[model samples]
Target: MTSEKGIAAVEFALALMGLLLFFAIFIQFFIFFAANERATFAGFAASRVFSVQGIGPAVETSEKIDSDSIMTFETNRVAVARQIPMPSGINNFLTQGRGFSIEIEIPTFNELDYKNRLEQDDNDF
Candidate 1:
């Protein structure tokens, strides 16, 4: 009589599970990378607008860029909120002074284009 060994079956199952786990982690990393790229793009766009024409221009630029991209941008003056000590006389001016900051938030890859490719139906078409 011949007996079949279960070692091969167990090994194959463990290997398959490991492969699935690896793919899951890889997908997560890819999504994070894509989100980071989009966020950086939005920040750059906001900064460029602010540098060229100031905060008022930044608002319009952000609106325009937001329309074209898959991220949201917000501009604000946060210098006042910082814990840095203000100079005696300059404190009053600093209170009214407007420093600019931009926040960019991007959605996940699943929201933009799943399956690892951009949609051909975009305006580029």
Candidate 2:
């Protein structure tokens, strides 16, 4: 009877540990999804800004880097919050202030034969 009680306690302890681990992973993935969506928005915003106004002709060299700090639209704090909590005691101790960035060679002016197909589609209608 005593052995049964000990085994039950052990099983419950193991189950609790596993449950906690699963919950922690679930929470991390949830936050990852949130960050991904936010990043998509930020990328679209940056692209829109450059596609219309362009990436040059107004650069003070410090104004357009597309990072979280450079682009205010990228306000997702996941990169800041999702730090690996180890290897502490250094200059970057608690946080690295890491963030996402968007850097791409934005082709323009009929590049890739990508004409305004919408105008042609409108004629069909």
Candidate 3:
């Protein structure tokens, strides 16, 4: 004497649980996509400022840009963008006097004998 009413209720509960799981996953994916997009846009915006004003002034501008002043995503996006200059390798090349300099070897062919691979790629190729 089993009726189908209990079976229908059980099936409905299972389907509802599955729907909730799917919604959770979708929301998580949406958050990740938004974060990645923000990071990318921040990188480009920071790069533009760097290209225009170089590293020191760009850092200063970022500090001056007042995080609370703007409610837009771009303001919050590049909050830590100024740290790129001091990233280990380039620290030695930057002096404290507000200018950045990197020794990009402008080499002719065979200039460093066997060690100018980077210059060859840039200048020759």
Candidate 4:
């Protein structure tokens, strides 16, 4: 009876360890996914601002997203980047940082040129 109880306890401990490991991995994956989503949202928001308000304000808004994230603007495009924070225990082997970068292009429009083109099209018709 005593030996059987010890064996059961050992089995339970092993199962518990496996469960803990799975939980840790789940948490890490959740963090990576959430961070990527946030980075993508920030990129789109910045791109929207760039399309409407111009580059300066858009860059400023993106820079304010988060300290761990980076935002860059090039011509009519904006990109937001971020790194996911992993749990300390898994840092040695899985310490590989997960991150996401979202890039968006905003089209520029010339109102005068567009109007002229429209008029020429109407004349041709």
lDDT of 1 at 64: 60
TM-scores of all candidate predictions against the true structure: 0.43, 0.50, 0.45, 0.69
Q: Write the per-residue lDDT of candidate 1 for residues 1-125, one digit (tens) a residue.
A: 12245777778899999999798657655654554554466556655565456666655655564433332333432111112233344445545543222245433223234433555545456
What does candidate 3 score on TM? 0.45
Give each model's clash number: 0, 0, 0, 0
| Superposed Cα deviation of residue 25, candidate 1 (Å) | 0.7
- Highest lDDT against the true fold, candidate: 4
lDDT ranking from best to worst? 4, 1, 3, 2
RMSD per candidate (Å) reads 19.6, 9.2, 15.6, 5.0
In candidate 4, residue 56 scores what lDDT?
82
What candidate 4 gets wrong by more than 4 Å, as runs, is: 63-67, 95-125
Native-referenced Cα lDDT, model 4: 0.69
* C-alpha lDDT score of every prediction, in listed order: 0.47, 0.44, 0.44, 0.69
Candidate 4: tens digits of C-alpha lDDT, residues 50-97: 767888887677667745567776655666656566555566555444
Please give the lDDT score for candidate 3.
Answer: 0.44
Count backbone overlaps in model 4: 0
- Residue 124 of model 4 has an lDDT of 100
**Model 1 regions lying over 4 Å from their true place:** 1-5, 53-125
Best by TM-score: 4
